[model samples]
Target: MGGFKATLINEIEKLYKKKKIIVAAALALIFIIVGQLATIALRNGFGVRTVGSMEFPILVLSVVANTIIPLFAALITIDSFSGEFSQNTMKISLTRPVTRFKFFTAKLTAIILFVFLNLMFVMVFSVLAGLIFNSNTLTAYGIIRIFISYIVTIFPMIILVMMIIFFSNLINSGIGVFFLSIIVFLGFKVLGILFSDYSGIFFTSMLDWYNLWIMSVFPFIKILREFLLLCSYGIILFTGGFYLFDKKNF
Candidate 1:
């Protein structure tokens, strides 16, 4: 346990040094500023409060979860897996007193931490932006809903990371893994659009799983069903990715 903690710390430090987190943070800030500005423009020019305080954050979350968060998840996963192998850095890490499983979990745990922090950062900034710009009194209940909504998003994001990690392990090149991830992700989006009825079955389609939680009446059955689906995907991808990472020559 102690060794795993140390390795996790090392993985996090490497991610911190890589600066992708900085880029993701900056992009999120930019998106919030732009979103608020657009909202202000609409209200001033066309006389509209289309996005209220709670609505603003929710809107930001949709974009962040669907686009920004997943994009960086792929990048970070590729960098941590494929980047390490291509750069011959994984060998150095493996030289330490650590088992392959420990190394894999530590690295993945670090990525999960990155996603969680990034999500929270977006939630905080978007909430503040909404409060500052939109004059909507989010009741305590509404605030609770927003918090729950943001927190629930982390589950799907983790599953997405696991999927990408699986691909990264299969493909040796960082660039190959990145392009393949994008192609596969975009393909999934297109398929979802073309096959609306079957879209619900895809893991990518569950990015907005938070909506089930934030509903007026809790859809317990639907939430549980989707939660179980996500859990299954997470478990399978994580096990498969771990197996590949463990057996790799690196």
Candidate 2:
């Protein structure tokens, strides 16, 4: 436990030193501000009805998942292994008493924590942006639902982080990992669309987890199915990455 804590702290400090967290927060805020501005322009300039405060965060989240969140996920996880390998930090860290599994777990935990923090920041900023721009009344139930949606989103986000981490371990270049992860992340969505008939079998379709909240009539079974699909993929990818890391020659 102590070793894991130390490793987690070290990973977080590295992120802080690199200003990755700061950059994530900045980018999230910028994305929210721009989205709100666009919403306002459409409402006032083009006479469109903007989404209500209750719905605004969901709308922003949909856009973020497609754009900002993927980029942020790639940026954070791209370095999980490739950066360590490139800088020879992995060798030094392995020389410690920590096992490769623990090191990998710590890195994965740090990136998940970072991504969760980034998502929370986005949620908060979206609410603030809505309050400033939208005239819809905010109800406690609405706020609770939004928060729940954010919590549900963590599952898909973890799947994405794991995919990037897997690729990072497979590839030795940080830039290569970054671009490839982004490409695969976005590519999955396109493939999901192209094969909409098999979206149920495709884990990438789970990226639209937000729809679980927006369903006019809640489909509990479908939601559970999608959640399970994501969890299965996450487990498989993470296990594969760990196996590769454990066996790889540094």
Candidate 3:
């Protein structure tokens, strides 16, 4: 347990040292500010009142999930997994007393922590933006709903992380891993669009799970089904990554 904790700490420290978290936070802030400004313009200038400040976080999340999150996931996974191999640093860690499983767990935990922090920043910033611009009074219920939405968002993100990590474990080239993951993500999105009837099979479709929170009538069954699909994909990709990592030659 102590070894795993140490590894986790080391992984997180490395992420900070590399400025991954800093970059992510900056991007989140910029995207939120720009998106909120555009939304405000549309609402007041163009009379598109459908876009509210309260909905800012949701809009930012939906847009980032499709664009920024996937790219970040691929880059982070490649840096954590494949970049070490490319730089010959992975062998040093492999020679250490820590088990491969513990090392892998630490890296995965770090990635998830980074993503969670980014999500928190988006939510907090969105709330602040809403208050400043939209005169949105923060209510206890609104706060609870934001937290719930964050939790729901985690499901799809886990699947994305696992998928990228799976590719990273398979490919030693960091750039190759990144491009392959992006291609796969885009392919899944295309598949979802072309086969809307079978959208359940595409993990990309689950990325829009935020809609469940925004809907007037919550479709519990659809949410449950999408949640299950994400879990299934997450499990498969994680297992594949573990198997590949264990069998991989250092």
The lDDT per prediction is 0.89, 0.80, 0.80
Q: On a 0 to 100 scale, what is the lDDT of residue 168 in model 1?
A: 88
Ten consecutive residues with minimal summed lDDT in candidate 2? 199-208
* Model 1 TM-score on a 0 to 1 scale: 0.97
Best by TM-score: 1
lDDT of 2 by residue, 1-250 (tens): 8888999999888876766667778888988888889888998999998788778898877777667776877787776578778888888888877878888999999888887877788899899888887646688977887787777787888888888888887888898888887677667778878988886766566656767765678889888888778879988999999988898887
lDDT of 1 by residue, 118-216 (tens): 999999999899888865667777678789989999998898899889998998988888888888888888898999998877888888888889888
Ranking by lDDT: 1, 2, 3
State candidate 3's TM-score.
0.92
Residue pairs in collision within model 1: none
Poorly placed runs, candidate 2 (over 4 Å): 214-216
Task: Give the TM-scores of the predictions, in the order they appear.
Answer: 0.97, 0.93, 0.92
Which of candidates 1 and 3 reaches a greater TM-score? 1
Candidate 1 weakest ten by summed lDDT: 134-143
Q: What is the lDDT of candidate 1?
A: 0.89
Window of ten residues with lowest summed lDDT in model 3: 50-59
- Give model 3's clash tally: 0
RMSD vs true structure, all candidates:
1.1, 1.7, 1.8
lDDT string for model 3 (1-250, tens) is 8889988998898887876667777887888888778877888898887555556666777777777666676677789888887888888877767898898888998998877777777888977887688775556766676677766787788788988889888877888887888788889888889989998788888877777875779898988888777778877888899899999887
